[model samples]
Target: MYSTDRRERTQIQQLTSFVKAWSQIDPATAPFLGTWTAWEETKSIYPSSVKGRVCIIDGFIPNENNIGFRFGQGTVSNGRIKTDSYILIHQGNYLGGVFVYNNEPGIYEYAWPKPLKNPAELMRRVPQSDRHRNHILEQFQNAGCTASRPNRR
Candidate 1:
């Protein structure tokens, strides 16, 4: 399908870039990849103004959601995924954030995009994220999500 305007084009490009980066995540961090919605409590505190937002980092452009211009690019590391924000506006001005996987609580806390009082104060995966993450795990190999998840939960 053809993009009818510049915004749509940019969105498509962002999704394309997102897919490329996400597919390479090392298996250990693969479980964190999915759609996420900010918990009600985090909305006001989130610097990105992500309150009431459903974030889909599933590497594919969603037909109904928008993740804006920011996308993730990072390597899978021990207990955390260090991600650099692929920002288009102020290129090198901001620091990248880290996503820490809390296995016991079954949550992923993202720190930064600007560090607040609580360093890891960002996002709690909702049902959509759970479903999407599980789907990715199930079809990881076929979906080209390169990383082979090794029971990191």
Candidate 2:
């Protein structure tokens, strides 16, 4: 079982690679696509997506809350990705599985469009509270990716 830090570190690296190869990302084969849940009140794992839903494609996060920007851009250079969803402004390394914006936090594991290849094994390493519960499943099912998700299921 990989530690939370390790898993998130790897996930961030994948996100970085995704941004670097944005133009080549085939939505049909993208791996990190899912509904990243935002918490308005607290990052409590019960009711998901309080603030809004954002999907990280190769380089954009389709904004649902009308946060001024039409689409939150994820541009990576010098190891730092400046994004409203993905944090770590000072530290260029480790973007985290959870995203924070305007005080609200988002958990990456909340939504999975398709069942993971090794969901059991992968989820086993995660903390009980952090395991995915299909929290934002309904949203993806309703709206589809819309540039905010990885692929259309």
Candidate 3:
């Protein structure tokens, strides 16, 4: 049990490092690191099947009110990457697993389709809380990364 617990802790640390690295390298993912609202106002329309569901994907998991650009396979563990992968909770219940990471090119494609049509449109539609989000995204878009992929090794 002690060994299992130690492995779990180490895995969490590894995954956090991967997320931090990926966030810095990918502009679209950077803003979401700190801000993800529950969007309680839209809960009545469609509730999250799992309460308090927080997992790192290319983007935040979109609840009804949280509709936005989301990339990557729904489950990171589904990928074949050895350094960064998903960790299953148990047999037959993969949804609850947390993704673990240790290296480059996370399970999701770092480059995602533009979520907003244009900067002007984004400025009009973005909520005050998310203004910075659009700005950073636009900067990266204008810089020609468009997808913010790390330089090929």
Off by over 4 Å in 2: 1-15, 23-53, 56-91, 94-135, 146-153
Q: Cα miss at 85, model 1 (Å)? A: 5.3
Q: What is the C-alpha lDDT of each candidate?
A: 0.28, 0.30, 0.29
Q: What range of 10 consecutive residues in model 1 has the weakest lDDT sum? A: 40-49
Tell me each candidate's TM-score: 0.24, 0.24, 0.21
Q: Model 1, range 1-153, lDDT digits (tens) per residue?
A: 122222345544543344345335333432333322232212111111121111223222333453221222334444333435321111121122223345332332221121112111121323445554444334432323222122223
> Model 1, stretches more than 4 Å misplaced?
1-26, 40-67, 85-153
Better of 1 and 2 by lDDT: 2
Q: How big is the positional error of residue 14 in model 1, measured in Å on the Cα after superposition?
A: 24
- Location of the lowest summed lDDT over 10 successive residues in candidate 2: 41-50
All candidates: CA RMSD (Å):
18.1, 12.8, 17.2
